[model samples]
Target: MCLNLPQMQSRLLLISPGQSYRLAPYLKAAERLGVSLTIVSDSRYSLTREVADGIQGDFTEPSALLDAIIAQAQTTPFSGVVASDDSTVELAARIATRLGLPTNSIASATLSHRKDLARRQLQAAGLPVPEHWQLDLAREIAPQLQGLPYPVVLKPVSLSASRGVIRANDPDEAAQACRTIARIIAPLSNPIERQTLLIECYLPGQEVALEGLLQQGVFTPLALFDKPDPLTGPYFEETYYITPSRLPDAIQQRIRQTVADACRIYGLHQGPVHAELRIDGNQVWILEIASRTIGGECSRSLDAVLARPLEEYVLAAAMGNPLPVERRSGASGVLMIPIPRAGVLRRINGVQEIRTLPHITDIRISMESGQVVETLPEASSYLGFIYSTADTPQAAEQALRNAHRALDITIDPLLNS
Candidate 1:
């Protein structure tokens, strides 16, 4: 099964390559464009030999990862370097630059990542956001802060997926929250593992995401994802998304413009960007942006929903190729992993109903029997995903829900209240 490299097109370097379970759609899209992707493992890669170029290693140590990418580029002549995960985006930028490739500036890349850095940079750019206070793990405690805002959000600047996010509604909750925060920090496999925590005023509003590309500082805005839940709590786990964002057309324009501005403010030059925002009516606050594609099943959802392959666009954009202007892209939807309590999956029923439903592409389940599921700190547990498309967003929504409702999921309780 030796495939000739000479016939291959784009040689893509995927840093931090892990579960491509979410990368299937992108891989399919790349194939459509005749792009040959090579995954350069960023850490203990579990996928196997066929996953990528097999540059197996970690990206936390920038120099090591940079050297590896350079080595691969020498042979592969990579048209693009993609950091498939949030943690390794910095490494991706360095790799692209070392090869005289297109990517965000190193400083901007780091700032666009790491929530704390992003906040500072955005604030400097005069964007509105939640008020915050940086912490000192050793500090005894601030004495004059008794009158501050309650329901504060304790979040790590580096990690996504609400990894180290906690909420404190009051001083007592804040104290307990502090202990949980300590636990969150102690398990750092690396120094960069959630090292910084910011206790900030929790903004009450709807949370949403903007997924698109920033090329040479010009923004080619794409989809706006609406997470239709109060994602504000202990661990803000995202559960669902709908395209043609529920936000009004005008408001959506503002969000795109704001995101583009944020990218420029952060000095993003190229590559896909995923940004989170909190909006209450017309007033929108910037949450954070990552210099990479939207995580979770989003890339798949977007590809299936839009009828346009995002990975191809990502590859084209990454390589300084032009992508289409944002226009009447079709509709698609996805519901992210949600909390279903702590349990072991027993059986899933009603899947037959999902199959019969129209406008549905796929229903995916990530966990299996005998596997432990935790839903606390917000409904962060995702049982799986349901992808659908339609002539209109409404039709897509109906078909997916019809499929979802027909299914019966039974799980063995692991931790019952």
Candidate 2:
């Protein structure tokens, strides 16, 4: 979709700063459209938050933060609010609604960010989705699950990037795994036992994502990407996303149609969308959907591969401006560097060699020398990303993975510190 011409000057308030974690694309998209950006608050642990301007109160407290932002926004006349992480997307929607601006419905935001809620909602809508259930931390394991199967996925309902997400082979294993998940959030919430849990029937097949723009609950599939690594069971950390997913045309159509129905069923409005689908046979299961934008280095992939200005689409939509319907053509992919353990930053190898590949467009390493990096203490652990675009999807896909494997990483722990 082509964004209508810019009607007026627009200034946007970015809720969180960008990085490899998530929402980096949202910030980059705003930059592409030349939208004036003021950092609202920082949620990550990096030193980057100091670069942000408005760091008032706290972000987790939705009401307090909302009031502060609205109070300040009235004077600044911030055109809109945006959040890129699953942790705060709903809050972003709430702030927009509170300000009487065009925003996604909070109920919709809740459905998208919380996996268990989304699955149930989609099931009600009769959309294809994974079989999942809510695991109350304080409740006993389901009695029927004693004879159940293994490899079931257990995760936090509202968490993303695989945070607190794990898999169990049997009910006994499931009970132990639930204990570990329960411990991770104790400091973050009181009576954390009430935290939402998801035990899902693990669906196997090639994992693919649909990147697009959703206008008034209508989903427009822009590009399809494939996940090379097996995302089932265990952790959900993504490794590579190569666009022009190798799926046949028929399968691609089915994926798009299924995702479109999901966006509508979940109340997605005008904005960027990131969707995950697992296909086995003719069955297509909707994994998750993000209302704000795609996480990881996907925006970079679309930029380098599709050769389009995605930031513009996000900026225009957030400002109530028309989104650019047509995107530049080309195939693109992004490789996310995975973490094996936590320790001090050391060194990276093979980037220079990988960059030598003809299809490789650019390579970025977010980890700094001497900086501490760890395996997803909770699943969002990625050091950096590799981006590439080419004439053919195969070439782009091959070049990205080959380049990624060729790259090396070295980490030395700062044990005493």
Candidate 3:
């Protein structure tokens, strides 16, 4: 559905990492909305034809990035600013705030981006969050790990997509996990993120993801996804996400309410919200909340139910003309194809076979053959994404599983390993 915005000539500035998978979809959405879009990233994009107005600025340096955006605004002012991913959301918020555009405050974005800060804010607000501890990486981790709860999950403060997240069963494991996480986050340029790690008591339950939009501090849930695959992990690498969730209606409402409360606590008043939570019996535990649409190609799953691409809503919200949140009947899902091992990909077999399966919509193999792939705690990208749709959530989830089973991924062990 093409959204007929009042500002038909509006230009949206999309801030994202150069390698983000979200850029193409958002660009397509912008075109569908009949709006001009500019690309802003730290690296150059090959889509020079689609993105005529591109700005390359280091995301690590906010002062320089903001200056560049302000300079660009003088010539071609953006009607709205949107962040395509978690890494760029805070900066997007900062840009929006600077330009006096509709956006959540920078503090809200920061709280959402930093796990440690989010936990503190949520706890202070009396929200159900796992007991967590922040460890100063500059000091000895072993001393910090002492007397902490066992079976805790340790992760870097700001890395998303479960990168550098590990579950430790005991003190020894916690110490080793911290060391491993340190190495995983070593390449990050942010001093605070590089120097701090969060260890939180692992909450065991069925996990779910909420995709919603916020307007004037009110959150409207777009989709509630059931993570059929158990996230009880030594490392939390998410796989399956099926929606309209199979959970009871009342429980689902509580999950939504929890997310809304979290948004209120963070003072998030506008744009898309992607929240992850754990349902432990009757208790709803907020795992993490991000001020962005659901990550990766997973957003495509919503098209089956929304009757339009999720990016349309996101773009509409960014442009300060949020379309009504509505869902048509049916269920959909996406499998974030997980990398099985650390190695160079040799070949992926059975794409044809998977496509033949019932309800299988698409199979995207993102990692090219011969490209090196890493598993969780260090892995950043998925092998690819598998999308499906059916009359029921079960059928949708089964379709994803069936598709995954049909494929045989072969990875050649790294020479060093």
What C-alpha lDDT does candidate 3 achieve relative to the native structure?
0.87
Better of 1 and 2 by TM-score: 1
Which ranges of candidate 3 are over 4 A from the true structure?
1-9, 45-50
lDDT (CA) for every model shown? 0.72, 0.72, 0.87
Candidate 2 ranges with C-alpha deviation above 4 Å: 1-9, 17-28, 42-55, 141-145, 187-194, 412-417
Worst 10 residues of 2 by lDDT: 1-10
**Candidate 2 residues 120-192, lDDT tens each?**
8999988887777777876666663565556688877666666677778888778877877876655553243
| Best-performing candidate as measured by lDDT | 3
* Model 1 lDDT at residue 24: 63
User: Which model is ahead, 1 or 2, in terms of lDDT?
Assistant: 2
Candidate 3: worst-modelled 10 consecutive residues by lDDT = 1-10
In candidate 1 the C-alpha lDDT for residue 274 amounts to: 89
lDDT of 1 by residue, 1-417 (tens): 111223324677666556645456556666777777776664464463554346767655667766665665666677777777776777777777787766777798888777777788788779887888776555654442366688788776676777667878887777666666666666655555434567789888898889888777778777888776677686687766778686788888889988988888888878888889998878889888888887646677777544466777787776566667544556788866464566777877776678668888888887786777776443334788888887777777777667767767777776655
Report the CA-based lDDT of candidate 1 relative to the real structure: 0.72
Model 3 lDDT per residue over 194-263, tens place: 9899999999999999999888788899999999888888999899999999999999999999999999
